[model samples]
Structure formats: C-alpha cells, structure tokens
Target: MMRTFPFGTAALLMLFCSIVSGAWLGLHPAAQKQADLTFWTFTKIHYDPYTETIPTFEQQHHCKVDLQLVDTRAVTSRLQAAMLSDVDVPDLVEIPIDFAPAFFRGPLEHVGFIDLTQRIHQAGLWDKMVQARFAPYTSRGHIFGLPHDVHPVQLAYRSDIFAQEGVDVSKIKTWDDFIRIGRKLTIPNKRYMLELYDFRSAHLEACMFQRGGGYFDPQGHCIFDNDIGVQTMLWFVPLVAGPHKIAGSIGSGQILTQAVEDGYFLCLVCPDWRSKSIEKDIPRMAGKMKLMPLPAVTANSRHTSTWGGTMLGITRHCKNPDLAWQLALHLYLNKKELGKRYEGTNILPALRAAWSEPSFSQPRPYWCNQPIGALYAKLAPDVPFQYTSPFIATAKDKLGEALVACVQYYNANGDNGFEPFVRATLKEKADQVRALAARNPY
Candidate 1:
C-alpha cells in the first residue's frame, strides 16, 4: 500500500508544483529597496537652499536624502576622520575654499574626492562654467569640485556720508586717488575712510589678488616675498598705521553693525555674499549703501578682487556617484535653482549660463536699487584666479605676521627705511614657510 504510487508519477507531481510556484512568484515580485544619500554642509545658509530643492531630486531618483548642518571646524575635522577611517561618511560635501587645500595634501590617487574632470567635460560643463573659479578645487590638473560662486569684491561705501562730505568717488580710479580723497573724509578714531583689520589678512589678500599677486605661484612655490607682494604690503601698512592711517578696525557682529549705523567707517570691502549679509544684519542700511569697482593698484590693473568661496564635490565613498553627480548639476547648473539660492544669499553663480536669470538684474531697494547682481556679474569675468596649496593658509598667516611686524615698525620708525624693513620681514617669513613646506612635501 505504501509503494502503491509509481516513481515516475511522483516525480512529475513534484515538478508541476515547482513550476506553479515559480510562475506565481514572478507575478508578485518583491519591492525594490530605496537608495539613500547623505549630504553635509558647514553653514545653515548653505544647507537651506539644498533642503528646498533636494526633494525634486529625490522624487525623480526614487531615493531618500539626509541633510546635515555642521559647524565649520567640526565639518573639517569629521571629514578628515571619516576619510581616514572609511566610516560614517557623507556622499556629498560642501568645502570652503579655505578648507579645500587640506584635502589636496595627499597624492592624487589617494585623494578623498572623486576625480570629476572627465565627467565635467563629458557633461559639457567645463565650458559652461567660469573657468577661473575652478582653480581652488583643482590639484595636479585634476578637477575635484564644482565651484559654488564667483565672489568678486567691490567697494561698499556709505553713499549718504560720501555725498555729505562732497567726495566724488567716481574719480577714485586708482589706490592713490582713493587715499587722497579718503584723507579728507578720515577723522582718526571718530570716523575712518575704510576698514582694514591690522591683525587679519583677508583685506590684504584681496588687494594682492587684485594686483595678480598671491601667496603661491602656479607651480605651488612660495612667492610671498615677490615684488608684487612687497609693493602691496608697503601700500597697505601705512593705511592701517602711522601718519597715513585712513582705515580702522570695525570688529564684527554687533560691533560691525553698530559701526555702520554710527558712521564709524565710511567704506567696506564688499564681496558678493557680504552684500547680502549687510542687508540682513543692518536692515536700516537699505537704500543708503552704494557699490563701486575696487580701486586698482594701477590704472591698467584689475579693478576687482575675490574673497570667500565654496565648492561641492562627490566623495570617493559614495555608493551612487551617478546620482550624486546629477544632484550637483541640479543644484549648481540649473538656473531656476541657482536663482532661488541667489534670492536669499546674493551669491553670483559660477555657471555662466545662470547669470542671465532675471533675479540677477532685478534692482533691489536694499542696495539703492543698484541692480547689485548685475554689477557683480560685470566683474565676475575679471575675478583673478587663486591657486591653492596645503601651505596657502600657513602662507597667509605668515603674511599676517609680517603685516603686524611692519605696522609696528612704521609706528616706531615712521616712513624712514619702511620699504627695506618690510622687504626683510617678508623674506624672513617666506624662508620660514619654505622650511615648513620642505618638512611636509606633498
């Protein structure tokens, strides 16, 4: 009775059951898992724009995104640690120009960021973007990140104060003319012509860039003691110290805003982003400020400089690089998205195609209806190229030290032998930088 069923029949029965199961499973397939991506930015303002726009990317790609807002110092530290440990890393990150050099310290193949040069060219974006803006994110001829903005610097002056003092800023084409007119407006501690922090090198760096001078040459060699560097430092020291002082330290935060309100400073070195900050921080300054091209070192020199900058790059650990690259293109190259960001940040897009957005040409009441965006766009093409290196920050700090020393020398010795002293001081600083570079050859 137990052997009653034939062997062939039993085998056929089992095969039929397996076929049925396979067909049924094919009709009701398992759900596909959704992809996940994480993004990190150092500033909340930078994070907000992506938050508003990333939903579109998620819907199209059928993925989820997690956005993080980390502080500047923490962002740098966490990124470095993650790169070293290969754990808990974001797929995409926003790197400030000041922090970009550190990531480039390693050999090309070992760099944390993906090499995007071929992708950029393949996407036809290499020619679509402002070519000079890529300098900060490039290393050894390999591009790693897409530039975030063209931070062209200009002169933001209190138009009301300038008019009241009968100073014609239009004639101020060169630094000499600026100083001549500034002398009449400068009143020592009461009111100063402009702001130049003696202890900080930002303003000085901008001026040097304007004259096509910087901490390092294109070959990544230290050139802080070159002719252009020496000339800029000599001209800059007298304005912040000695008898020719026409600049003052206006501090920051409430102190800066209060100084603007109290007319403690007449002019400021305004980059594109700083204009927006001025709008938000000092609301009462609306319609009272006007922008002009920065006075050049010479009539033939560039009239504009650059200040802060940022870039977005895909990390080497990204699980979905294709998706990340698409997202970057959406955030940086799409005119509508860039327009939305510019409305809040007043940053000029590095993508040349986005410059034609109406938002850029719109006259805002905050800046005396000056079409602030248009003004910056005119200078964007001329913004100088800034080279990056691991020693750039250190070189800048050394220049700051040299500035302090030169100021001290001017204060005690006046203008006598000032050039020689500055030359010697900068040479000594340059030598120190060379020594450090030798110890850490990259």
Candidate 2:
C-alpha cells in the first residue's frame, strides 16, 4: 500500500510556513507571444514517455516545443558542421552516456549549451542525475546528462517449458552451467534453452567488466582487446556451435523479441525495460512470459549489464535552462503526471523512489510474476559509464570489416581470425589517438 503523509493540528502552523515558502518559489515572467524550444532526440519523441510528457511542460511554460529526431550515424561530423557553420542546432539535445566522452573533446564549446554544473550541484541531485550509477562517465568532475531510464539486461524464459522439462532454476548457476543445462533441455522441438544475438549480445560489456576490463582507463584508450576481451569473446564461440544452440543463430534474431518472430526459442535475454515492447509487440504471449534475474555468471558474479537506455537533460543552450531543468525534474517527480505515464506506458523509472510505488511493486503474470524490481536492483551496482572515441568509433567500423575475416576461423571453431583483426584495428586506433593527443586539437 502507498503511504500518504497527513498534517496534524499541532503541525499545521509549521506546514503553513513550509507551504508558503515552497509556493513562493521562482515564478517566471509571463509570455504573451509564443516561444519555440527545439529539442533534438534520437528516439521518436512522441513514442517515449519523456517525449510525450513534454506537452504538459509546454502548456505550463507557455512555450511551443519543436522536436527533431537526430541520428547518431556520422554524428560527430554533423555536430562539427553545425558548430562550424553557426547554423541550426537544437536548443536541447539528447546524447547517450557512451558518447559523452567525445563531447568532452571540444565539439560542444561553440554550441552555447548552458553548463549545468552549478545548477545540478545546487539541485543536490548532481550525483543522482548525472553521476548516478555510472559515475566514472562524468567528465572533469562535472555532471552533464540525466538518465532517461535504465534497461539493464535481465533473463526472460518460459516458465511453462521449464516446468515440463523439470529444469530447476536453482541448478543453473554459471553461464557454463547455463549452457550445459540448456543443452539438456533441448527437447528437439519443444524448447532449446535460450537465444541471443552473437552480435550486440549483452556479453560484450558484461564479460569485459566481469573480467576486470574497463572500457577505458584514465588515459582514455580502448582496452577491449585484453585478456578480458579475449575471454569474453571465447565464451560466445561455444554458444554459437554448441549442442543447445540458440534460435535464429543460423541467421539473426537471438534476443527475446527477435526470436518472437519464430517462437521457436523458449528463453531469451532481454532488458528489464522491455515490458512495454513485450506487451505491445508480443501480446499473444501476455500473462505467459516471465521475467527473472539474470542467472549468475559465477557464484560470486552478478548476471547483469547495461545495454540500452537513456536519460533526460537540459542542454547549456536553453534560453530558459532553469525552467527547462524544472520541467525535466517534473517529468521524473510529478507523481500524478509522470506516474500515470510510467504505469500506463509500462516504462521503468530511473528514480529510486519510483520503484517502491505500488504500481511498480506488483508483478505481471505474463512474465512469470518475476520479482522485477528486486532482481533489477541487484544489477544496478555493475552498470558502468560507457566510453566512446573518434578512434574507438572508427575502430568499430574497422572491427566490423574485420569480423568477416574472423568468420572463416570462427566457422572452423578456431577463434583465431577475430583477434588478429581486432589487434590490428586497435593498434591503428591507438596510434591515431596518440598522434591526435600530441597535436592537442582542443
């Protein structure tokens, strides 16, 4: 049950004083003419709760919001062009946590984005907003963006199938053990364990972190080619050709939603925020699909990793950044307004308090009545700040090409080709980054 605080007769005077203090807070000057605030976003804004909730904000602020969908492909160059040309740049923009490092370089200076440094600190939520779980990502000891929502990886498996197969959940402990039992549960036609995409598999960062690999050290060099990287990659080879091979492994579609097209795979790996997508896209399986903690990797390790999610932010560019930040806060805190959206839309809240709400506490049977909140909280500690670089991004392109060369050795189950390609790519990136640093482009 949700708790409500009530004022007593004795405290009424105090309450009156508090209410007056709060009510007298900052009130902006009224605007007769319309003002437009341009917001650039990657997600189709209308589809996301943060996007849809803006109308209420616009109404309150008496402003018209023009939203644009910005694509990240060739993003730095596009941002550079906008900066250099002194042309159109959105008043407020969304950039993922991974790309924050690149912005730290200099592309952001010309944009006139209001430095939220002091404001966020004054709000006292600097840690919670920009420096939350992913603390390492904040550059130069200043917080920049606020989390949109977190979609940490979680387990999605068919309870009905597990029951019939007597695959005891407690028995599955490690990923290796997971593979072993998954191999046994391969009932030929019924269910063949779990499915996951070889590429974009949650394992990429999970294993990297699991084996003590940081995406970048203080020096900002990609070390994904180290032992942690090698071990992480090696873990996937078995799953690709193993006895309990995942669904659509032959082609594409290795995740829960992706495998939904065939319904051949009984289990899949997905993020906790997938409730909205699962319900809307796979309605037929409603009340049947179950959510569970990612099974353990080691007896000591937690099976969770951040995959995809975003946060809200007020760019330094906003003319009324204070009000903009307030609106951003309203979207997260206004229980009646934001709360309704979260419940109605099945979107997860990034705020810690939101989860304790009754609406969030209850379980949905379609997901096997999994203890969604409790399980997800455990994964929170492991979430890291994603790092990106011009060198790393360019290297990823080369890595994609390198995957083709690795394919032959991969097909032969040798695991030889990927390393050479990755090594060569990383060496070039390192050299390039070193030279760029020497030049000090900033």
Candidate 3:
C-alpha cells in the first residue's frame, strides 16, 4: 500500500537521490569524468617529463595519472604483492634489465605484464627503438616492455692521471694493451690502475659482453664457460690478485666516494648512467675524467657492451591498455620528450631519432670537454644484443662469489692456479643455473 507519485515528481525525486548519493560518496562531477591511472617508478627523475606530458594527455584523454615513486626493492616487492592479491595494482611500472628477464621468462598471458609486441609493431616503434634494448624484455616470442634508455658501457679514465703516467689512450687499443698500461700505473699499495666496487661483477661482465660472451646465449643456455668467457676470466683473475694487482676492491657508499675523490682509481668502467653519477658524486674530480671506447678484446672487435637500463611496461591490471601504451609512448617514444628526458637526466635516449639533437654534439667541460653524448651515440648503435634468463640475478651473485674466491685464493697461495680455478668455478655456476632453469617453469 505505497503511495505512487506523479511522473514529474518521481523524476525529480530520482535526480535528487542521484545527487545525494554522489555527494555522500565524495565523487564530484569532474572526478567521475576523469579516468584514473596509476604509474609506479623507482625514480622521481622521470617526474619532470611526466609533469610536462601527463597534464596534456589528461586534457586530451580526460584521464588523470598518479605517479608513485618508490624504492627500487620496494617496486618489485609491491608489484609482486599487488599481483598476488589482485588489489591496489598500478597500471604501469618500470622494470630494469636485470629483473625484466625473470618476468619475461614466463608466458605473457600468465604474467602480470601485458604483451606489447603488436602495439610496438603497429606503431612502427620496433624499428625506431634501440634494437639491443629489446633483448632483455623479450620472452618466448613476445615483447613485454618499451625501452626507456640505451646504457652503452664506456671506459672513463682520469685524463690527468693517464697523461701523468704516460698511458696513451690511442695506442692502448686492445685488452692486452690496457692490462700492460694498467700494470705500469700500479704503485704497490697506494693506488691502482682501476677500482672494483663490492657489488656484482659488472666490470668483468662488461668486458665479457664486449668480447661477445655472456651468462647465457639467446636461446637461454649457459655459455659462460665458453672460450670467450674462459679468456675473460683468465684476464680478470690476475688483475684482481697477487702483488701485480691492477684492480683493487673499494666497498660502496662513502668509501667509494672517498676513493674516487682521493684519486685511488685511474680508470673506471662506466655505463652512460654511471657517467652522470660521477659528475654528481665526485664533483671535486671535475675536468680530470675522460671517456673512451672500451678496450677491445681483440684489436678488431667491432662492438661494445651495455649495462643497466629500464623498460616501461603496462601491467595486466590496466583498465585501459590503449591509453597506458599511449602514455608510455608520450614519455619515451616521442622524440621531443626523449630529448627533454636526456637534457634533464642525462638519460641516453633509446630512440635513434633523438640522437640527432644538438645537445648530443655539445662538448661538456665535466669530462675534459669531451662530447659525451656524441660518443655514447656512436656506441649505442653497436651495443651487442645481450640476453638474460630468469636465473640471471642469482647467477650474477654466484659469479661475484666465484670472483671474490678466486682473488682470495691467489692472494693466499701466490700460485698460478687462478685461471683453472676460475674456469672450474664458472662451469660449476653455469651448471647450477642450467639446473635451476630446467626445474623452474618458463
């Protein structure tokens, strides 16, 4: 026995109820109209670029993007948790090369990431992006991420020290030459020709990569005990051991800063990103550093190696994959935005077209007035394709342990046993990784 309202009265009552519900829920008209997107990244260095483009994109797409900056470790932990819980997941995330392979190793449909293969091909981005940057993010037959930068490895030497030591860069073209010059620069206890941070064997790996060797082949098989790898280990063993130590380990943080500032290292193996950090950390060493192509394994090696990079990926939780892809493209694929990112962060653009910018040609006084960008540009195209499997991160740890152990053995025994020991250790580690890969899915 309810009283029925007239047509106009009922319509007015319904509208009033809608307004009340909206107000109660704290949902304004503008808020309801905007599509919200969440982006998680490890660095706020990307904020400026996002600030520039996101607003424009929001206006055009009627979407609001919220960027969350988190710690590197936190990014992976949170991403994994969110995926597991299926709640509070970001629409986009930045994955590094070292961690990307693990994610990409699984089937694309089963992983938390979206497959970007068709979109990349259709947008013509496949040809425009740095080809080598795609390696770590490709799995099975699908590409899962868009490359954010090219991290070509280079040798940054103290120019003043090299000149003082009569170590001519032009003549030291091969690894043998580099080692000879390094031996000459060694002064027993006070200083060494190079420095090693107590991190992973990035320096050694960079050398191995330049020699066309890596932890695994493109087919995801371990090849670290191959001829090239054996040769690399043989060379690395002596440099870190005995009375003829050309490289000394400097633990990270303030000690590393102090070492670099105190001029304990004549040369440092640097990636493009590392070059930026040197300028930021050891400002006192300004104008003393210089960039050179990596010392080749052979006199005629045509390629260089790369280290450390990031890739922008869309998560499976994205409500609008199309828009998320658009945002990623705006941030990284657009030449203008790429140029801005480079200017702001010294992030070497993965887009080949962006390399022609005038800044790439400009000389910087920070590195003895070297055209750093141009040199990196030349090296970028030649960076060899490096592949990693899911076991890569653990494999790196094992390899580092082997490296430390080899150095300790030599330092203790003073015997010519390091090469054989390193070879055996590398083989053992390779077997471990292979067995792990076989047992693990994908």
Candidate 4:
C-alpha cells in the first residue's frame, strides 16, 4: 500500500517542492538584486551556510551570491522543468547522490557542473575524500562530487531490559547472539525487543553490509541476491515473522516512522541523524538511548554498514561559474565552518580533516556523547560508486514490492511458512537485478 523509491519521476519532485513554499524568504535577493551568481540548494541550514559564507568571498573578491533555496526532493524536477522551459539555471546546486547521475545528461551536461576531479586532486584530499565518498555518493573513475559525512547506525537497545534479561551485549557479538538477546528480552504483551517494520530494510541492509553485501560492486554488478545477502536477511526476517514475535510486521513505511517517534517500540538500529530527529520529535526516549556497534558477523569483524548523507555540487549554469566554484568549495571544504555546521545542525562535516578534531573524537552531551563517531566512521573504501545503471532505480521499487509481498504472504500462511515466500520473493527480484545488470553491464 506504500509508495516505492521514485528515482525518475517528475511528479514526485513537484510534490516535494510544493511542500517547502512557506517558512522562509531567507535569500538576500534585495541586497544582490544585480547579483551575477546563482546557487540552488535544498532547504537546510547546512545548504544555507553557503549563502551566508559568500559575504566573506564577496568581501574578498567583490561578487554577490544569488542562492535559491529548494527542498532536496524537488531538485531534479526543478532542473528538468528549467531545461524544458529554457529558463535561467543557478550557477551552483547541491544534488544528493540519488539524483546526480540523472543530471549527468542534458542541459546540466551542456552547461554542467565544473568537474572538480582535478581540483580535488590538487587539494590533495582526493584519497581521504575517496575513502568517505562511497557512503555519501556513488562515484566513478572520475570523482563526480564532494562527499558529506556518512550516516551510520548504532544499535540503541534498552540497557535496563538487557540487564533484566541477563544479556551481556559485550559478549553477544554474532548475529546469533543478537537474536538470542532479542528473543529473551521480547516479553510479548509487555514489550517488543526489536521492531522490524517497513524501514527494517535499513537494518537488513546494515546486516548485509556486515556480511559484505553492498549497494553495488566496483564494476557495478548487481549482487543483492548473493549468498551473504540471503543469509543476512534470513537471520532476521524469519525471526520477525512470529515465533520470535518481533514488533508487528511493518517495513519502513510512514506509519513506522511515526510509531518509532511515539516510543511505541523500545529498541531500534538508528543512524546519527536520528539523534537530532528523535530529540526533537520523540522526547520520551532521550536519555534511555544507548549505543553499540552494529552487531557483528564474526564478532570482531566490526565492519558495519552506513547510510549516506548529502554533498555540495556546483551547477555549470551561472554567469560567474568559477566564482561559484570558489564559494562552494570554500564552504564545504573549510574545516572550521564545517565543524560549526556539524555540531550545530546535527549535520556531519565532509572535510576529512574535521574528524581528527577533539570535538569528533570526544564523547558528547547528545548521542550519550560517546566516542562512537570515531569508531563507526571508517567506511568501506571500495564500495561500488557507479550507480548509473537505469535498472537500479527500478530494482529499488521492485524490492519494496517484494518486501511487501513477504509481509502479506507470511501474514496469510504463517503455518505453511517462510521458505515458500522467501524463495518466491527473493529469487524473482534478485533475478531481475542480475538480468538488468547483464544487459546494461554496470
């Protein structure tokens, strides 16, 4: 009944833009009415900083920034609409990893972003950026865009319950240990130790990443159906079905988001970004939240999966393209300003140098102020960045459908059981990705 990832759709983009029409007129359009620079950004304090940061650039080099604030989801459609209308385009824009590949074609390509591959290399942070870029955006042979920080989850379980259940998480290292802990703590009518919902894919993929399944291969092959992926999902999906009685079956849907916010559920595998979201939205679970590295595959193989965040990009369209580039790079690449934005906005910084700061390494007032960031910050260096395949988007939709069907199939026949549904669900979707990969050769 829920919608899937709509990668290419223009309608969804429009819907997103429409939602952000109010609560601001933060632009300095009046001051820079004659400005030659135009930078388009999504609605966020992090993006807005570029606008404010430009005065320093302006003071130094006499130029004005004409920044257009937009919602992230609306970026693609607005650009597409601009092309069809042949309207003026901004000089700089922040396209998240999901929409970057689509912009690789058309007007963007014609008057496209200043490819900073050389500049990045010149800055000498290319290798460090490359190390973190996979979590932020998928890159190709040529580094496409700058990386923001990665959003990785730590297992935040109820410590009180763990103590009550005699579960020592420090000793419980494997996936099996996690299950045993989850099962022992699940007190049916009293509490659900784990809430596997529609959004459970985030957790599932995290597990898959621990087992070495990634979004794509360096050669861009589809490996979702690889044995590691199957086994990882098999470990949790069945446990959530019934006997284990994990929270009622909800995949990552809107309802589940609300449910988690309400504290209806106790434990969740949450990303760092959620720290801010929960503090604001779910005040009930504030101090109780505790962190753990994602439960490991071989215990000591602490490698974990991370969901990526946003990055900055310069559009090839401005009247002063080079000026735009300087400002974009200055704001994103600056360590001091990046740290300010990182701590204040709950937005992490992309500058690799920023991580070495005492601020990042130390425990915090928020997030239990644990030194967890330093530990979970090491992203897999070789994640496949070439996400340009046309079928990747479709596969996301189909995968959502497959997840939904599993829920329906199990709910209908929980007795006859999971093998029938699991086999039918995974193989069909997995084969589609494999076949698509073969044809496109990603």
**What are the lDDT scores of the predictions, listed in order?**
0.88, 0.57, 0.80, 0.59
Ranking by TM-score: 1, 3, 4, 2
Tens-digit lDDT track of model 3 for 1-442: 1245456776878887999998987754445324478998887777656777778778888888988787888888788889889988899999777877776655657888998999999988889988888877777767888998888988888898788777779887877788888888788777888875434577778778888888878877878878888787777867878778788777766777788777788878888888878888878888999989887877788446888888889999999898898888878867776766676677788899998888777788889889898899998988877777878897787777767777777778765676788789888877877888888666
Which runs of model 4 end up more than 4 angstroms from their true locations? 1-33, 48-52, 105-112, 130-140, 160-166, 247-263, 369-391, 409-424, 430-442
Q: List model 4 lDDT by residue over 1-442, tens digit each.
A: 1157465457777666666553244432335357767777775655566656677778887876667788887887887677567676666677765566555443324534556677677867676554545333333444456666556556666555566667776876666677776666566655566665543354555566666665456545566656665565555566556455555544444655565554445577666665555556555545555667666767566545555456566655556656766776777677777665655555555556766656556665444556644644543332223233334455555555566666566667764766656666767887777776565422
**TM of each candidate vs. truth:** 0.91, 0.74, 0.88, 0.78
Candidate 2 per-residue C-alpha lDDT over 1-442 given as tens digits, one digit per residue, 9 for 90 to 100: 1123365655776787888877766354444434467666665432466566788888888877776676755444565566566566556666654554455565445323455567667766645532433343344444456666655666677666677778787777677777777777665555556665444434455445545554555455655555665555556544544334543243432344555544567676667656566666676776567766566557877666656555455555467776667766776666555445656555555665565566665666666676555566556655545544434444344433333333334666564555665456445544554565555454
Alpha-carbon lDDT of model 4: 0.59
The number of the candidate with the highest lDDT is 1
| Worst-scoring 10-residue span by lDDT in model 3 | 26-35
As a TM-score, model 3 comes out at 0.88
Clashing pairs in 1: none
For 1-442, candidate 1 gives per-residue lDDT tens digits of 2255566777877877899999999998987534487888898778888889999988988888888898888888999999999988889999899898788777888889999999999988878888889888888789998898999999999999988888888889999999999898888889899988898789988988998888887667888799989999998999999877999796898899999989998899999999988898989998899999999888877889999899898999999999889888888988988987898999999998788899999999987899989899999999998987778788889999999999999999988999999999999999998998888656
Span of 10 residues, lowest total lDDT, candidate 1: 1-10
Cα RMSD to the true fold for all candidates? 10.6, 16.6, 7.7, 11.2
Which whole-number lDDT from 0 to 100 does residue 103 have in model 1? Answer: 87
Give the better candidate number (2 or 4) by TM-score.
4
Residue 152 CA error for candidate 3 (Å)?
Answer: 0.4
**TM-score of predicted structure 2:** 0.74
Candidates ranked by lDDT, best first? 1, 3, 4, 2
